[model samples]
Each structure stands twice: as structure tokens, then as C-alpha cells.
Target: MSNEHTTITESLAKVATRANELCNTVDAQIDNIKNTLKAEQDALQAKKTQFDAQAASSISQYQGKMDDFIESGDNRYQKALSKGDVIVPVNLKHLDDSKFYPVTLYHCKMLDVRVERYVHDDVSGGGILDYFVQLQNWSNGGDFTFAKQFHHSYSGRAFVGKISAASTPYTSSIWLRGGWSYKFYLNGHYSKGPVVIESETQVVERIASTDYFLAPITEVQPHVAANNFILGV
Candidate 1:
């Protein structure tokens, strides 16, 4: 009986040891699985954070572009409402006597004139005496009405004259709503018969009353010590 009891006790001890070893193996496997899962979770979370930051930056850039486009459109609209359409100058010398000068004016309230007179160096006897430029509007076929006139005198080598409606009443500001065609006629003569002369006329469209104020101030000082600054006509 004692031998049977010892054998049974030994067998029970072996069973307990086997059970402990199985439990330890299972615990180690569970720990390894947990670590793997945790590492995968951390990697996924990092990728998610990077994607979120990139998305936010892209959204911000797109919003800024949209705002700039809107502002640019608004600025263009305001400028169109405030400013007048520019009228390009036409050279009268190029046009023939049969053809009348044609110009389109949109919201034109004032007219700006620039006349340049250049005399040849070889010109000795004759010089520019009385020079006048007239603006005539003939929207009604043959009948024409004078709009503005600029009278200037040139004597020396080269002369440049600028005349505005504000300074001279003869070249006063005129309002034209609808598009109208205007003609420029230059009536001038020289002292000693026909002399080589070059002349140009420019008409600028003004939208506001203070448009003339924006012109650049040109200082014209006479060479003579006693004479003051000569104001060009």
C-alpha cells in the first residue's frame, strides 16, 4: 500500500508541473501578440496625424486663392465704374482733306490737348506765327459745330505746348454721353512761305473733375535771368 501511494503522489506532481509549463507558454504568446498589436496601432495613429495636417494645409491654400480671385474681380469692377475709356490720339497730318478724323468718346467730361512743334535747323527766314487747332463735331452729316480750340505761338528752335480745358476757356471741358465722331482741323501759317514743320495733337478723355490734377507738373523756366517761368499755352 505505501508503494502504491508514493507512485500516485509522484504522478500527481508531474501533472501539476506540466500544467504550469503550458500556462507559462500561453502567457508569453499573449504578451508577444499584445506588443505586435500595440506597435501596429502606433504606426496607424502616426499616419493618421500626418494625413490630417496635409489636408488642413491644402484647404488653407485653396481658400487663400479663392479670396484673391474674388478681390481681383471686385477691384476690376470698381475701376471700370470710376475710370473712363481711353481714347487714342490721331495724327491730323496723316489724314487727307476728303477724310474727316474719327474718334470715339465714352463718358468724356474733359479734353486734354498736347501739341508739339518742331522746326528744322535750316529754317532761317520763316517761323511759326499764328497757330490754331480746332475740334469740330459733325455727327449730323455735313453740319459741324466747333467743340474746342487751342491757339499757340512758336518762335525759336523747338517748342512743346500743352493746353487743358481747365486753363483755357476756349478749350473748355465738354460732356459727351453717346459715342460721337469728332474731327481735328489745324489752321496755321508761316512767315516766309511754306516751311518744314512737324506738329501733333492729342485728346485725352477725363472722367472726374480732378483728373487734370493728376498730370505731372512741368517746370518751364526761361533762360533769361530777368524773365520768370514761361507758362506754355
Candidate 2:
């Protein structure tokens, strides 16, 4: 009887050891699965963040282009100037038969005139210059009224502005698009219009009357000095 009992106790001990070993194996497997699921969740979150950033950048670019389009279309002038949205003055001059020969010049920052992109050039001494419109030599009866609006580029943005005829009842309407100044000539006259300056750069001598070269009779001296500093039209 003692031998039989001892044998039964040994058998029970073996069964209990096997059951504990099986439980330990199951616990290890459960821990591994939890770790794998956590890793996968972290990876998915990273991918989502990357996709969101790319989507935001794309939206910003599209919105920027749309803003440029709408800005170019806004016109201060009542009349449409040209078939082209913005006018670039190549070598514009007037005909002999016209009452007043109209010549329009777009004083640009040079790099701003690209059709695909408006590039700004900050090269030293590479500044504003007169760009006169040149009519097609063959299109004789064509009028100068088309090349009216001028577009300017600054701070990597394209801005549309206008220079209209002062002959009408209008008050020589002008638009300032974050620039130091703009120069124009009407019927062989220079400095007849006002020189707009950023209020900060404006000096009392800039708009005062002076006998400087290219200074208009009606222009204040302070503006003439400003034109001199910027080099006149």
C-alpha cells in the first residue's frame, strides 16, 4: 500500500508540473502577440502622419496658385487692356495720325515676368528698368488700349496693377502692391504722375518741388528726390 501511494503521489506531481509549463508557454505567446500588435499600431500611426503632411503641402500649393489667378483678374480700370492678362511693354509708341500717341512702360523687377512662374531676382544692382511695349509692326490699325494693365512681382508673389489715362474724369487711379515706386510717361511727359513711396521711406525732401532732371512740373520736390535716388524714368 505504501509503494502504491508513493507512486500515485509521484504521478500527481508530474501532472501538476506539466500543467504549469503549459500555462507559462501560453503566457509567453500572449505577451509576444501584444508586443507585435503594439508595433503595428505605431507603424500605422507614423504612416498616417507622413500622409497628412504631404496632403497639407499639396493643398497649400494649390491654394497659392488660385490666389494668384484671382488677384491677376482684379482690375481697377473700367476697360480691358489686352488679350493677354498682363501687359509687358516691349517698345510701345504712338502713330502719326493719333491725337496723342500713347506709350506705356511697365517698370518691373525683371524676374517677375515669367508666364509659368513669377521669379524674384535680388541680384545686386539688378533693379527696376523701363519696359516699353512694342506693337506688332504688321498690325497697323491695332490700338494701344489693349496693353493697359501692368503686373508686378514682389516677395515671391505676383500683383496686378494699372496705369490708366489721366484724360478722363478719373483721379489717375493707381494701385500699390508692396513696392518702393513706379514710373510712367504719358504723351512724352515724365513725372507728371505721383511717385508713391512706402510711408516709412518717405522723406520731406522727396516730395518737395525741385528742378531736377525728369522731374514733372507738378511733382513735389520730395518725390523728385526719391525719383533721383531710384533713378528717374
The numbered model that scores best in lDDT is 1
Q: Per-residue CA lDDT of candidate 2, range 1-233, in tens?
A: 99999999999999999999999999999999999999999999999999999999999999988887677654522123322444332221121211111122222111111111123223333244332221111112132222232332233222213333331221122322332222333322122223332232223121245321111121122211221122223
List per-prediction Cα lDDT, in the order shown.
0.37, 0.35
lDDT of 1 by residue, 111-168 (tens): 2232322343224432332223333322221333333434444554212222222222
Candidate 2, after superposition: displacement of residue 206 in Å? 61
Scored by TM-score, the top model is 2
Model 1's TM-score against the true structure: 0.31
Query: Where is model 1 more than 4 Å wrong at Cα?
Result: 73-233
Global CA lDDT of candidate 1, please?
Answer: 0.37
